[model samples]
Target chain A: MMAKSQTHSDGDLGDLLRVRDGFVLADVDTRSTPGYGQTKSDAQDDLAAGAEEFDELQERLYAQSRENPDSPAVLLVLQAMDTAGKGGIVRHVIGATDPQGIHLKAFKKPTPEELEHDFLWRIEREVPRAGYIGVFDRSHYEDVLIGRVRSLATPDEIERRYDAINDFERRITDAGVHLVKVMLHISKDEQRERLAERLERPDKHWKFNPGDIDERQLWDDYMGAYQVVLDRTSTPHAPWHVVPADRKWYARLAVQALLLDVLERIDPQWPVASFDVEAEKERLAAS
Target chain B: MMAKSQTHSDGDLGDLLRVRDGFVLADVDTRSTPGYGQTKSDAQDDLAAGAEEFDELQERLYAQSRENPDSPAVLLVLQAMDTAGKGGIVRHVIGATDPQGIHLKAFKKPTPEELEHDFLWRIEREVPRAGYIGVFDRSHYEDVLIGRVRSLATPDEIERRYDAINDFERRITDAGVHLVKVMLHISKDEQRERLAERLERPDKHWKFNPGDIDERQLWDDYMGAYQVVLDRTSTPHAPWHVVPADRKWYARLAVQALLLDVLERIDPQWPVASFDVEAEKERLAAS
Candidate 1:
């Protein structure tokens, strides 16, 4: 199912995966840093307004999907580090979705039963049907991210899974499932701050895992793993959108934009009127 | 916290429960049904329009939550029998929501560790924060539903849980969490039809579980179990809506109406401008 599709020129993958020593090594300091290279002074204002406008468009698209039940489905996969705001993104970015049509599956550490099947079996069962949308909090990408970071998979095995993911995602898209994958990028400082907050707040305590600190220690290793994962798996069928998540608004805006763009591309229709009105009308006239 | 808030004067508990069971037990004949009565004609239309409307409103409510960072969170829980459309409703209803501010958690049979805690503990941790929405495909209600259905909990034990659930939900609401519960009701024949279709279709085979049919055989018992569950647990704070799932549209619409009503009540805000230039300028000129 692999498409010898053109490279990332049409998408944001190349720039998104730019990294060194794995930590998304970039000069992403928003406050003191100058604006995104080519954008204008009012880019922020424009971006915000554009996001809201896209939101309006999205509302309509969603309504259209419901009104016309035959519309193609939307599937979103979120892959991120522990404190990288996967939960935050789900809470904030897609917060406005209709609960009836949105399917969310969160893949945590696999259970013994889950381990019995091939890695993607659980996810395969959870894919949204046509005209629906599915969001994976942590997706099949785990095979690469955690596996590579932990060195659980051999180098050859990691490479093979990359090809496998490419094939799997291509089949889904070929079957008309529009896919969007996002990697929320947060700096070490931000991670530390959020981790502390999770620990400090009583209600947030449930979210804190001491294991996350251990993962944080391997930040560089994970970054190296993500760089290769991005390079190998970012395909035309399902490209990655790596948003700067330290600043929440920008992250939300980027995700919304990517969704709007893809959904509009595969704009689906509600089922056609089941009964033929003209035929019924003709029969009535003849009677 | 229990307000005998008797807002539901639409009908008597017994009558409504009877109506509920009547609707569930109503044969394939929608033409002349007891609970449906004359409500059938408009029921089809309402189902169609209602499902779409519910999805639209849910998306908007979720969006409002995201934009207004301080808005109270919304929790949507779906508890129902097999093939009752828990997965279907989640997909069709909330699919359009922005992924950032919405959290979707599906609870399966308990893991060993999860079984260790009180049923509510894991679910409590999964609730979305302020300015977010959370949807549970199965939830703490399992403590009552499955516990009662499987006869795992005695009648007295289940009775104590009613108050505990009320208190737990009340605490969530008091903490600024809005709760919405939907019970999707599908007739036995429709379920049989659906099961047959799943068996016939290759892609749908994964969804077909023989266990679902086993549960269906105990349909009447499940109905009585649900009635008790609904009666004991439906409080003024988090009243339960028994959605008619025979027509998918009606199921979606009723859910939408409830969601829109709740969100309108919440009325989340747009962020206050950091710099209100007009007001600042006016003050400066006056000075």
Candidate 2:
């Protein structure tokens, strides 16, 4: 219904953005609008509209869990190069709902304890409980992505991790958790502009780390790792959406729309009153 | 600068709403927009503007923490009667900032594990980590309020909790944690209308517990418990703000204003660049 006939055609955003078996990371034009044909302002309006929907749906999800603890929950996994708008999605998109229902975990460098265990051990502990929307800023995929690019893990170890991740995600999805995986696709030139801007502004200095330049130098390796990931781990239960993130507004809009699509499908209903209404009303009136 | 000249006059909102030793719960006019002199629509406009300021100030605080891990963090302790709009504050007020920098805990009735430890033990663990905004929807105050009213704890135990709370708060403040304690004061009539509405709306029934009526019956005791709480815990380190809750907008605006005032006073600065700006820009441009 939101599909406009200006510069874009119609299809579900989930279908439009999902990467199947042969998606080459280099083939995606980072600046292309893809499924969205609207102007920037229109997308902004849609974002606001979608946010209201997210709040209502998320609240229902939260409410349903209160009635039934076994109710379905959602997990949004965000993977991206540095400055690929991961935090922006957290702020402007998921930030629209109640924080009570949103469980957010930002995985930084693994701690000494985390390094000692299987990589997914820390991740397993932080999975969103029922009736909550869980968001992972950087996830277990880092073990495969950075783990591959930096030789942090051996080739055999990296090879087994893809299957481990698929198995883990399958387990989560089978347990009634809806998983939405996103890889923010930004072009090398686009990253240059972003990094350059960060350097140009003193206010954003805290966000810029020298290691970012080192990562930039290994962009192709990261892209290759991402491609390998999509080929190996894009399952029916937990499909990955490769969102073009050169435009911050578009990335936020696409993710919001996709999430709305999933929430709509889940269709969490308002919980039924566990107590008798008539008796309660009379008692309330007396009180 | 956000102070409206009309309904709300010129002193800081922190000073305007802070309760001192002689404060009485029964004397507060729940429906009055005490410090907010503006209409509801005007207050809504201020809320939006303040959200933007909150975003900026909060980012500065977050950024400062990245540079110095030992930076000061904020904790907003919300203690309210049911239907006093604590959830609304979490969704609307604290919801305005980045989730990465915000830590929210909604403490329900403690489970057996929580009861096994001291009341403040669970609370001690979740005190927002360094450089974050921690929000407790209904916090440790529950220990005293419900504990005192229901005789859940011994009378002697109840007497010791006041000093326990003060000492705990003092330790927190001394360790560079700024505590903003709020008690949402609603009248008996207001509670009836709110509870009535919950019972009336099918969608709101999940929020209504028959137990709420039981608690409503002890309104006088809860009020007495609150009076003692304000009398004891309202210290210079963590002063309590008694916000009139019948007017939701004013309570939200006052709390947001109070938080902003603290952030303004803290004056989190832009971190100085650790790397050479020109060198990074040149490297970025070349990449």
Task: Compute DockQ for each candidate against the true complex.
Answer: 0.10, 0.82
Give lDDT per model, in order: 0.63, 0.88
Residue A98 alpha-carbon offset, candidate 2, angstroms = 1.8
Q: Model 1, residue A47: displacement in angstroms?
A: 8.7
What is the C-alpha lDDT profile of model 2 across B9-125, one tens digit per residue? 556677778998788778888998776667899889888988989988889988888888788899999999889999899888999889889999989899999999999999999
Stretches of candidate 1 off by over 4 Å are A1-71, A269-271, A278-287, B1-287
Q: Residue A203's C-alpha lDDT in candidate 1?
A: 39
Query: Per-residue alpha-carbon lDDT of model 2 for A1-287, expressed as tens digits?
Result: 13332224356778888888777778888998777877899888778877888999999999999989889999999999999999999999999988989999999999999999999999999889889999999999999999999999889999999999999999988888999999998998888888888888889888899899999999999999999999998988898999999999999988887788788889999999999999999999999
TM-score of 1: 0.50
Q: Which stretches in model 2 have alpha-carbon errors above 4 Å?
A: A1-9, B1-7
Query: lDDT at A28 for candidate 1?
Result: 51
Write model 1 residue lDDT over A184-256, tens digit each, in one string.
7787778877776755554344455556777887888887777777777777667776667776655654565
